[model samples]
Target: MKRPPYLKTSIGIGVLFIILMFLQSWLEKQPEALTASSEPETQTEATAVQPSERLVEDKRVYEGHNGTNLEHVYITIFDQSAVPENDITFYDLNESYKQYSNLDSGPKLDILFQTGTAKGPSDNGFISFGTDKPNATIELRGRSSRLEAQKSYKIRLQDNGGLWYGQSVINLNKHADDRTRVRNMLAFDYFRRIPDLISLRTNFVQLHVKDLTDPSSEGKFKSYGLYTHVEQLNEEALAARGLNPDGHLYKAENFEFYRYPDQLNHQNDPNYDKKKFEQVLKINGNENHDELLQMLDDINDLSKPFDEVFDTYFQEDNYLTWLAVNILFGNYDTMSTNYYLYSPLNSKKWYFIPWDFDKALGRDAERTDGLPQWQQGIQRYWGTVLHRRYLRDPENAAALTAKIEELSAIITEKTTKELIDSYYPVVKQLALQEPDLSYLGIEASEFDPAYRKLEQVTSRYKEQYMKSLEVPMPIFLHYERKNGRDVFTWEASHDLQNDKLSYEFQLSKTPGFESLIMQIKEQPDFTYNMAALPAGRYYWRVLVHDDKGHEQIPFDYYRDNAGIVYWGVQQIVVPGGSSS
Candidate 1:
């Protein structure tokens, strides 16, 4: 029965009271209240716009805002050489910047210095925030996530000392508006707290670009809006993490080790066409990555014991940790891409590094049936193979499940809700004041209420996530197609929470399931006579649902690449000759 309104109100009050008390207790224990600091440790500020000045000017101080305290970073980039020449600049910064979206080779751009504030010396004024080096070279970055309006960037800090955060390369992420901006930040933050994993450091930076050629300009930089600053994983990053700096570092764009040089994934050559491989991975220090290829060879080798293959080639904890985190965050997009693989030069063990999490926290805006979309399918070949091995060994499955349970507390409703409650007011206040917010589909006028609603919508995900019942995958028994009747059976799924479960079998003409031809409900197996069905190809899968109305991705779906993008789902062709 539904609780009465007064009782529900009382329960809500009790929850809020507890949260407020907890936050108060937690804050009392901390040396400082949670706040945004522009600088980490390097503390390089090249300009006069001091941190104190920006905080004071931008209204980020806790002084006036409603319980909001912030110190947002600002970057002023000037085209020093583009000095106006007879109403024409030597280089058109604005136009040249636009061409990069379409051009294979973007124009070279140089930065004289990067200026930003520090949490420590806000009073010291804005200093040149960059590597010990003086300046930088900037270019476009990203693969499928790239957009013309919101562009990601790669900054090569001059080798001498131009690194930001004491590194040579930096990735500036322009998370599209459709993506919750905090998704990437939250993932990185969570990874950092986990032991043994190499987590990327992230911060927000406000960028401004100027066009010197336009005589209409009073010398002032135009706001480029907000961006998430991520340190590029390179040799320097490895060194920082106490690993071999010269170790082979590969940031996956579309990596599938099993398909090397086979047309899709990059070729397994140390000398794989630099330009071609550049499209997929940043092949750092290992132009001849024979070790990576060997690892893949070992992975695909059926003769090798499954336990030995993973234990010898991969630091399983790192893989397991990365896998566990992604699964909880609902980032299925990461299995094939949005990750980094690195190996020490002397040691053959490879580690998985987390990357690209803007799609996390929730699957997407729509919580249809309260299930996160990110939890749907693992569509990468490497992931599928690993999962297949996991199935072959129950020990690995138990261990993985254990890891998920252990980490689940971190993503629990109470914890995430607490974070959302505390962070929203501060970050929302800061993001709203950002200039050029229009490009991100954020308008200056809508800052107050827009961010408020975003926080509300974003945090609702935790409710569903916390209530979600973690169900073991269904097992595929056997399939037989006799007389054009396809019969598939699967072991029933059991809910860890003891929630009742029902099965739904689906067959679609397309992998996207845009149009469903058949649905079988409350059954563990399916029998569909397709002889009379169309002669084209079809995809099939079974979804197990709980009494709570949560559904689990089929076992075969996890063991193989499936979906509209991957065609990994079970399949049958009419007038059948073969099926997967």
Candidate 2:
């Protein structure tokens, strides 16, 4: 067969194109070579600044990591030696359990940290540390998780050192209570995709640590197992996230929107104690707190309408989106704390940014039963003054519901299911290895069910959100000993329909209220008088009922060491010879 001239030329070009495509594919499949040196592989100014520029332009790729984006990090601890020329040895690094008691605010230890990159699925990561002695300080971090044998950590780059992926402080969360180990990361990842909400950067990290505190010990780095590296919320983080770094930022340590006259005064006030102020709201950026105090004052003043204050002092979309995300995720711990408040220098509006979501997505519910019975709805936020005022209005409540529905449509069950599926294989094998396995909250055999349960956790919370709109907000119960008698009092519940309300008060010896020592029902008054309780401990609760037959429990709850929450229960202890 004879071919024409043009046909022959076309055949030649086709063959060449296939060969080049095969060559490119082969090159792409190969692993990336290890960097020759560890001094951060010097880069031109432009190359170094491009990522940050891209961050300002495109937020989608900000701190974005895939399911398979598992990274390895090595940290080597060293003593505070004055001699800079001394050789590093196993004796330089030491471990002492006595110093680990206060992980919440303990002093940090100087450590040399290095990170590795794996370009492909089959690549084995490597670390390089050349002449960069110790550039950071590491401290045991977390509130309750500090009690766990395995601990989370806070790593801060010190001495004007280089940034770790454009961050000064890095929070590596172990999520000790969550067996799935990815609930916190999942929440942040999902929020990152939502436009209305401000999201932080997060990635999966595998940590290795070596302790040379003991002279006789070998200083080999041991696998600390898998951790989720959540970017610390600070001025640097805010700037990177496109926020006003020079604006006010405060982490709610124990703030409930109260105008604490004695504690939370301005820095210029004579009685203003920084320690006392920090106990309630930890100052993170822009120490000037006049705006925050003003907002708190407005929230505390019942004379001002909440909607007006909300419109004047808050971004409506930001507030609603934060509330809606927390509701759907079931992050009930945010009533007084576990969130950040920010206000730009030029604006009167305050914004809510979520933090510490480890307890969200039914992770707590899986460990505890009946925890969400009272904590599941808009009423769950009644403990906070701001939320109480906001939710008391029907319009704001409906607005929150609409926001929840909007987010629900975007982050559907299938969407979450795919996320869980993607994250499962990445941490499955690593979770079973070394330290993580020893501290595993659930059995190895239960990972499948745990993840499967997580897929439906958010949706279940959404259903609860809808049902919560049917009931009134839970009342705040008060107790005092008055003239030899025990008096129980609580605020009247706010019903949307303006229905007649009645109270049912029950006193019990056990927390579960299995047997009631005293039961008072169908009472119209908010106050109940009873004889002095015995010199032992007792439990009590008040249930609210409406004319249309809607019932709701109180906002109070009792939490045990196991994280089990008993809702609507309050405890009283009587001294043998004194009325209390």
Candidate 3:
């Protein structure tokens, strides 16, 4: 067969895949960064042995700092390919830089770290290691913060004599949003806390990027700021979970059905063999994806009932729980691409692992319609067809809402609130780790995300944290023009636990209400006299407010400000008419 139709990938992605693999493998093998230069007693010594190579003691680990188990690993890269650092461009972050070579060997490395220290100087021993050749990629810009400078990074950590964690490859997520550096980490935390969910681990780290090859600043190093150490869901992860280590672990992209073996290539293999379809997954681990493909075929085959096929692969509760968590957290980013699917020998059963949750629990970014959500959809496969079948049914919809309510209870039982609050110091501490970060207002005191994050938790997440809460994110129901008047009505947003919220409404002539024609409070419906105004289209939306001007929540006694509890928007054409 010509590889399953469901697993569609680019016509030719092997070159890109090969380059990425080389970069990841080489990055992993390089030694971790050592202590800050200020800490002499905790210094990591580097000894040149042969061919500009040296042993770097990498003590990029810490036991307890910022109330989390994380390591401050430093990395320094040297371009030895005769091509100058200035010659490299930003495209190296994706497209292979002509100078990078996509080879795991060549560049000189110095990975060292101080022992028994999170920040301050220590008297303990140090460890180090080095690599002459490392596959590399540049850390590109605008993906996170404007203050950030271009840097280079790799996923693989070197085997430094049991000093570092067993996991090899990882993507260092530079806490980019600048709002809550821990947005992804917190989502991972919640996922791990939930029963039976497969969640990856993350920690904080400090980075140092410099040029040992550039004649201008060969020995000089610059701070790249703090980064979140995120573990990749690879074959190693499967082994740790007591599952078949040799099974397939597919990292989703564009929500496509990635069951074809032809779409991916193995990390070490350079030759693009069309016959070796089994190795097509980009994160393709252990060489077999047959089980996964079968499930996809079944899931997409409309001939069979959706329940029958869904049962063949996924556990209903897990699916529902994932849905509930995403909805509750407003993780609009929860698409197939941000998830990893694990399959054993036969595709009859699979496990779900959510990934890249930087968009979670940060704002009231909810969607009223569409798949993969407008905010999260990245022009890729939105999700499996089975997902639509489950949520599309009234019965299933009710069950999922109930599940969301149940999870909401657990979150409001002071768990999620505590989790969110306790992490404030950790995030703040991580941001404050490097003294140089503040000069650019990156982690400055005036730029803290604590208060705004609190507002999000209390306002956007208000209904979820409250007991037996209702008011389903107010939506625009109907609008009409009759009898020379414009009438607009919307679904009311109220809580069953306490009907103490009032409807705050605003209507404006423009899309963004720089000026408003009508501002009404405590009303779910409004009417405008068409005969009394100009003929044109107007925009409107509803905002919910508390009866007491502001409301105090149970968990942490968080008093929420006057905010839009629910959201809905619509436009109406006012047909002007003459009136007496």
Candidate 4:
């Protein structure tokens, strides 16, 4: 009855095999348990690691009116939250502002705020302001982490305390036309009506306005306005064309109301008509005759009919007329510095263009002599004193006075007031068509204040014209080294009395010698040995003190005077020991 031993052994082996299969099935069902065991370890690895933080900063120069320069800038971020340990790097916006090391002096401003993540805290982040020049460092103890994520920081600059002049913003209300319509119309007109014009289409969008007017909406309204026909020259463009790179050529952007001066373009020419000079001289016999003639020559040479010049100074009268119109509006800021005379590429002719029309319409003064209210609005927004000094030269002053008399005859009191009345209705109609600007307190009724102010300023300008008629034209001279010798030059003049029959030279490149260089008592033309000059830039100016030790008022020729006038770089080696 007992089973064979082999059967018992086989039965035991089958039971063991069954148990093994059951274990395998249970393990397959426990996959969740295995994954749960590994989760904590993966998260722990991630939590223990931190991201690296790095920031890159850059600086550059931005140029403005009358050789005024600004530092343009940008920064790059590599990490989201980590703070940079080193000071940010800055680059010079222009070569003129570069230090000895060729580095920008950085903004010398300081920011003060409470420390916190919230919006209203001081010391929230390190804030800097002002120039980076020596003895101008303003630093604070604060973490850089407070800077907003994925945002840029921009700094605007001014020379003197914000008093002298600085960047400003202007917000133009949308025109009577809608955005799309304006864009299309401008494009069509640009192509069909004025093919030579360069056009940029801007919108009334908040962001575009913000970019132009930094520091937000609180900036002065003088910074923003609508100036339709402003002309501006591109100095860089003209330089590229091998034309007069000095920025004396016509540019379309110059037509902006804020850019052109309120005065006439041609002033203080030595070559001014003898009959006119005699009239002015008779009134102011003590006037510096020689200096006045030189200035007239320079002005005429620059503003003369472009066709008459030796292929370099030719400009169109239509462009000049546009400038004249802007000037008539009392936009008196343009001159040699801010305004430009430009010649197009592949063309020999040059033209004048208006620039920066923000101060037009005499906004700050009362209506007088029936000048249009809009034309009088400019007095409210005066330019820097430097502007007045440059624009009111004897020639420009005289010419402007004549033009104003002419304008007065044409733009009679009744007609000027009528123009104002017409402008009010049109502006009112436009306001009704557009509602967004109402929020900014701009309504048709407010136009009167702007208009009346312009009128008053225009009257003052007329007074200036009368006074200028009593003064003789001013004179000036500039000398540069050509062919390795100093060539004494004066502004082109027709008057024999204003010609540089002789001159004296005072040479000093360093700032210390400025006084000595200015002290040359007399001489028509003087030359210094080239061998005496060191291998570096040298500056020298001519003092055409006339027969007397007196020169024209320095302010009259600020743009032409007070800068490096010569160069003494290392000699270049040419083939066969001939150096050029």
Model 1 local distance difference test score? 0.53
- Which candidate would rank higher by TM-score, 1 or 2? 2
- TM-score of predicted structure 3: 0.56
For each candidate, give its TM-score against the true structure.
0.62, 0.82, 0.56, 0.29
Model 3 alpha-carbon drift over 4 Å, by segment: 1-70, 79-152, 158-163, 216-221, 256-281, 363-384, 429-446, 449-580
Q: In candidate 3, what residue range of length 10 has the lowest lDDT sum?
A: 48-57
Question: Model 4 segments beyond 4 Å from truth?
Answer: 1-312, 316-327, 340-342, 363-450, 456-463, 474-553, 556-580
Report residue 345 deviation for candidate 4 (angstroms): 4.6
Instruction: Give the winner by lDDT: 1 or 4.
Output: 1
| Residue 109 Cα positional deviation in candidate 4, in Å, after optimal superposition | 22
Name the candidate that leads on TM-score.
2
lDDT (C-alpha, whole model) for all candidates:
0.53, 0.73, 0.48, 0.29
For 96-168, candidate 3 gives per-residue lDDT tens digits of 3333432232222333333233453233322332333333333432222323442324445444422235466
Model 1 TM-score on a 0 to 1 scale: 0.62
In candidate 4, what are the lDDT values of residues 311-380, reduced to their tens digit?
A: 2332222232333344454554443223333333333344443333333444223222233221222121
- If ranked by TM-score, best first, what sequence of candidates would result? 2, 1, 3, 4
Q: Which is superior by lDDT, 2 or 3?
A: 2
Q: Evaluate residue 92 in candidate 1 and report its C-alpha lDDT on the 0 to 100 scale.
A: 42
